[model samples]
Target chain A: MSTNQIFIVDDDDAIRDALGWLFRSRGHVARLWSSAEALIAGGEIGRCGCLLLDIRMDGMSGLELFEWLRENGHDIPVIFLTGHGDVPMAVAALKKGAFDFVEKPFNDNELVDRALAALDIHHQRSSRQAAAREVDERLAQLTSRELEVMERVLAGQMNKVIAMDLGVTMRTVEVHRARIFDKMGVRSAVELAQLLTARTPKPD
Target chain B: MSTNQIFIVDDDDAIRDALGWLFRSRGHVARLWSSAEALIAGGEIGRCGCLLLDIRMDGMSGLELFEWLRENGHDIPVIFLTGHGDVPMAVAALKKGAFDFVEKPFNDNELVDRALAALDIHHQRSSRQAAAREVDERLAQLTSRELEVMERVLAGQMNKVIAMDLGVTMRTVEVHRARIFDKMGVRSAVELAQLLTARTPKPD
Candidate 1:
C-alpha cells in the first residue's frame, strides 16, 4: 500500500481545511478536496487510504461518490462526515459498506482514530490483492501442457496414468510436472494446490 | 446453527415486548429480556443469533454485557439500542466491535433489517468456525505414524523419500499414505493440503 493517508472532502472551507491540518499534523498526507467531484478529478481514485467525505456535498454528494466507488470496483474504506440530520444517511451508507461515520463536531481524537482504523482495513485489503495478483501472474506463466499436467498432479494422479491419459510417455509427463512446479514457484504439487487454495474467498 | 433469532435486552418492558413481537412477526424466535442479567441467567450465552442490547440497563449495562461477552469469547454480533444522548456511547461501543447500533425511536423496519444483517454475519462466522472444527476433528483421527506420513505428504515428499526417512519400505509408506488419505477424507495429497490451507486465517 502506501503511508497512512486520509482524503478529506467537504464543501465547507473551514471543516475541510481543519481536517486536513489535523490529519497532516498526525503525519498523514491529507488530501483536501472541496467536493467529491474534485476528488475524482484530482486522480486520487485508486489510492490506498481512508476517505473522509462530507455526507452532503454541493456536487457529487459523498453518498453518490461512495456508490460510484463501489460500482467501479474500488474498495477504499470510507468514513462519512455528517451533521446530526445526516446521521441516518451515514448509517444507511454504512449498510452499503462505508466503514463508519463521524457526526459533525466529531471529537478530533475520535475522527482521527476512526480514520486510522479505516487505513488499517485498506492496508489489509491491498496486501491481499497483491498476493492474489502475484499468484495469478505465476499461474499465467504455465504452458498448456504444463497446466494439464499440473491439474492431474494436483488431483493425485500418478505419472504413468497421466501419461497414458494424455497419450504421452511417462518421461514427458514428468518433465511437464517439473516445469509446472517451477513456474508456480512450488517444489511440490501439494504446495501448488495450497498456493491457489489460500487465495480462495470464503463465503461471506 | 439455529433459525433466525434475536435477543432483545432492554431495561424498558414495553420496548422489549414490542421488539419481541416485531421479530416474531418476521418469523424469528425472539428472546426478550428486561435486562442483560436476565438474558445471561436464561442461558442464551452460546446461542447463534443477533443481540439487540440497550446501552443502559438496570442491573448490567448493555456495554458491560458486551464487554463480558467479548472477554468470555462469545462472538454473537451485537447491535446497541441508543437514545439520542447515547449516540456517543453507541459509537464508542461500535469502535470496540459492536456490529451496529439503532438510535431510538429507530425506524422499525431499519432496526429489523440491521438485526437480520447481523444474523447474516453471525451465520458466516458460525459456518467458518464449524469448518475449522471439522478439519480439526479429521486431523485428530490420525495416528501418530499416519500423521507423520500426512505431514510429509503435504510437504510434497515422494513415497520413496518418506519411506527412507521413516526407515520403512516403499510398500509401508504407500499403505500409510493411503490410510492418511482415507482418514482425511481426501482423494489426493493436494486435496488434503488445500483443505488445510482453506482454513488458514489471513493476516488482519
Candidate 2:
C-alpha cells in the first residue's frame, strides 16, 4: 500500500500543531489546514488519502464540509473529531457515511488506529473501483461484430445461430469468439455472461 | 485474485445441487458435501475456498462445523444458508465471523452478489497478507547491521547517532540509508516507517 497523506482541518492552532507534531513523530506526513476552504482550495481531494476533520469550525462546520464534498462527488474517507455535545451530530454523519468519529481528548493511539483503518479501507475501495474501470476498458476492446456475438453468446446462443444471424460462416464466428474470450480473459461463454451481467448498468 | 474452490455442505440434496450448479455455471469449482465429516474427509481445510453451509443439518449443524473449523485453525469464510427459523443462529454465526448468511428460498441474484463480494474481500485480505510477506522477505535481505541502521533510521534517529550506535562512520550510515530507501521504494524515513507499521499484526 502507498503511504497516505493526512489532511487535518482544525481551527485551533494549538490542537493543529499538537496533532501535526504527533503525526510527524510517528513517521507520518500531516498537512494542517485552519479552515475547510483552505483544505478544499489545496486541491488534495482527488489524490488517494484521508481527511482528519474537526466537527466544529469557525465558518464551515465539519458536517457541512462533508456534505459539500459529497455533493461535489469527492469520495475521500473522513474521520471526524467531535466534542461531547457533538456526539449526536457525529453519529448522524456516520449514518451518512462518515468513516468514524473520535470524541475530544481521545487516546492518541485510538485516533491513529482509526485513521489507519480508514486509510486502508479508502485504498481498497479505490483499487476496487480502478479494477472495475479496467474491466470496462477491456470490454470496450471488442469490435462491434464481436460485441454482437458476445451478446448472443451471453443470451445462451450457439455459434451456429450467431453465424447465421450475422450471415457469416461458423468458422468466422468461432474466430471472433476466440478473440472475445482472449480479450475478456474468460474461459467459457457462461463466465463471460456472468461478467457482462455484473457490469451492466441497471436502470435507476 | 486467484479463484477459490467453494465447499457447499448441506443436507438438502436439492439445495446442494442448485448451489453446485450455480457455482459451476459461473465457472467456479464447487464440492458439495452432505455432512461435515464428508467435507473434512474430502481434503485439507487449507485447500478449500469458502464454505456455503446449512445451519441445520442432521449429524453436524453449521455452528458445530464453524466451531470445529475455528478450533482447527481453518480460517476460510463461511456463508450460512439458513431456514426461516434459523435467523438467530445465522446472526450468531455472523458474530463468529461467518462471512454472511442468507435465508432459505433466497433470491439467487442476491446470494450470488453477496458471494462475489465476500470472495473479493477474501482475495484482498489474502493479497495484503502476501504483500506483508513480501515486505518481510525484503527486510530479511538486509544484514543484521543493515537492519539495525534501518530501525534507527525509522525511529527518526540522526545519521551521526546511528553511526555511533553501529560503530560506523557517518558516510557509511548514509550509504546504508540510501540502499534502504531504494530497496523499500520510499523517498524518506517517515514513508518507510509508514509502510512498515501499516502491516504490523493487530490483536483481534
Candidate 3:
C-alpha cells in the first residue's frame, strides 16, 4: 500500500479482512495488521495517514501506541476501534490527542466517514506546520537588531521606549521597525503579533 | 462607558485611579473597581469587553476572580496587571484563560495596546458564539424525522441503512436528507457536520 493507505492494527483476523474489503469497496486501500507489533514491523511510522487501531488487543493496547506516537511527534491521526466497554478509555485517548473512536458493531459508513474527517485533520495540521516553517524562514531574514525591535514592538513598546531600551535614537528605532514590518510582511504591530503567534487551537 | 472600555479591578486606589487616567488619555474609558467584590456587584459579567485586573490584592485575588468568571462562563478577555514578584502568578493566570499580563511598572502605551488586543479576542469569541447560536437555531427548524435522518447521515450512515433503521424507504430517506441540507444551508454531510460543530476555541 502507498503512504496514504489507512493502517489498520487489530488482532482479530475477521475484523482485518472485513475492514480491508470495506475500504476497497469505498475506492480506498487499507493496510491491515494482525497486531500492533506487526504494524511497527511494517516500518510505516511517520507516514501521513490515519490509523484505525483496536483498543484492546493481546499485547500493546491502542492507548500505549497512541502515547508512543505522540512522544515521537508523528503527525498521523488515530481513530480507536473500540468495543462498547472501551469508551472511557477511548474518551481518555481523545483528550490525549486521538482523533475519534468508533465502537464495534459500528456502521461501515460511519467508520469511513470518521476516517475521512481524520484525514482532513491530518492535512490541516500538516499545512499549518508548513506555514509555520515558512513564517520562521521569513523571521530569520531579519537582522539581530531588527529582531529585537520586532520583539519589543510585539510586546507593545513605543518607539521612544524601545529606543531608550536599546540605547538608540527614536528615529533609529522607527527605521528598524519599518524594516522589520517590511520583512515580516505585516502592516501593524497587531498583524505582526498574529502572524508570529499563528498557532491557534484547532477545532476537534 | 464605551464598548471598548477597559474594566480595571485593583484593591489599590492608586493603581485603579492611575489606570483610569491612562486609558482616558488613550481615547478609551476605564471602569474602575476597588475590589473584585465591587466588580461582581457592578453586574457586568456577561458583557463583551477586556478586563485589566491586578493579580494580587488583599482579598479575592485576580486569579480567584479569573476562576470565578470562567466557572460562570463569562466571555470577557482578562489581562492581568502584575508586580515583579507576581510574574509567576500572572503566568499561571494566563494558562488559566487570561489574554495577557502586563508587568509593573508597565508603560501606559503597552498596557493599552494589550487591552485593545484583549478586546479583539472578546469580540472574536462573541462572534463565534453568535454563529454557533445561529447554527443551533437552524437545527431547531428540522422535523423530528429529518433530525433523526440528519443524525444518521452525520454518523456516516448510508441511505439504505438509515431507511432500514427508520422503517422507511430509501427514497424517503433521500428526501429527508435533501430537506436537511436545505434547512441547514449545507451542501454535503461534511459541510453539515462542520456547521453543526462551529464553536471556535477561546484564545489562551
Measured on C-alpha atoms, candidate 1 has an lDDT of 0.83
Cα lDDT tens digits for candidate 2, B70-157: 8986767788887753323443455466777677777888778777766766676666667878888888777777788887876557
Query: How does each model score on lDDT?
Result: 0.83, 0.76, 0.76
Docking class of 2: incorrect
lDDT of 2 at B24: 89
Query: How much is the TM-score of the A chain of model 2?
Result: 0.78
TM-score of each: 0.82, 0.45, 0.48
Evaluating just chain A, the predictions reach TM-scores of 0.84, 0.78, 0.76
Candidate 2, pairs of clashing residues: none
Report the Cα lDDT for residue A163, model 1: 98
CA-based DockQ, model 1: 0.44
Model 3, range A5-67, lDDT digits (tens) per residue? 788888889988999899889887688888877777777765637899998898888878878
Index of the highest-TM-score prediction: 1
